[model samples]
Target: ISVWTTLAALLGGMLAADVVLGVTPAYFFAALPRAVAISNLWLALGKSMVFGLSIALIGCHYGLRVKPNTESLGQGTTASVVTAITVVLLVDAVFAVVFKNVGL
Candidate 1:
């Protein structure tokens, strides 16, 4: 699901980029392959899997740690969301750094 969502977003973004830059769709599509190599796509997909799982786990962990009180529950839920976002960004940074040499 995440991969599909990412793909859909990528397509939309590509189209938007073309319109914003006043480039022809044909040319944009033609250059896309070279701009984003196949290896980069695969690497992004692979990292998406890792990122999705890790984010889910982080959310679940934080959620399960909640206390019985309503306030605690709210706090836990907020924390889970914030933490998940942080984790995802951190993981993304890590991927950028680690995969830099790999052409991601």
Candidate 2:
């Protein structure tokens, strides 16, 4: 899921950049690799994978804690989504801090 999501995001972003900035596809593709460090790319992929896994696990955890009531189920799902988003943001901030010296 992460791989596909990443691919779609990259493709969409590239296409949008091209349209907005008048950058040709060939030039964009050519400059992409040179513009980004390999380590940074790997770090992004790792973060995405971790975020996906963490969200899934956290969602399951909250989901299983739901009581046998409609209110509890809605509350659990809402909490799961909110917590997952917060966790991802916090993790991203941590990565930004940790990679501050790495030129990420």
Q: Give all TM-scores, in the order shown.
A: 0.72, 0.76
Tens-digit lDDT track of model 1 for 35-95? 7778877887899899889988988898889989999999999998899889899989998
* Error in Å for residue 49 of model 2: 0.7
Residue 60 CA displacement from its true place in model 2, Å: 1.1
Instruction: Write down the worst ten-residue block by lDDT for model 1.
Output: 95-104
lDDT of every predicted structure (CA atoms): 0.84, 0.86
C-alpha lDDT of candidate 1 relative to the true structure: 0.84
Q: Would you give me the overall lDDT of model 2?
A: 0.86
What is the per-residue lDDT of model 2 for residues 9-84, given as tens digits with 9 covering 90 to 100?
A: 7788789988999888888788887877778767877898888899999999998899999999999999999999
- Roughly what TM-score does model 2 have, to 2 decimal places? 0.76
> What is candidate 2's CA lDDT for residue 74?
95
What is the Cα-based lDDT of residue 63 in candidate 1? 84
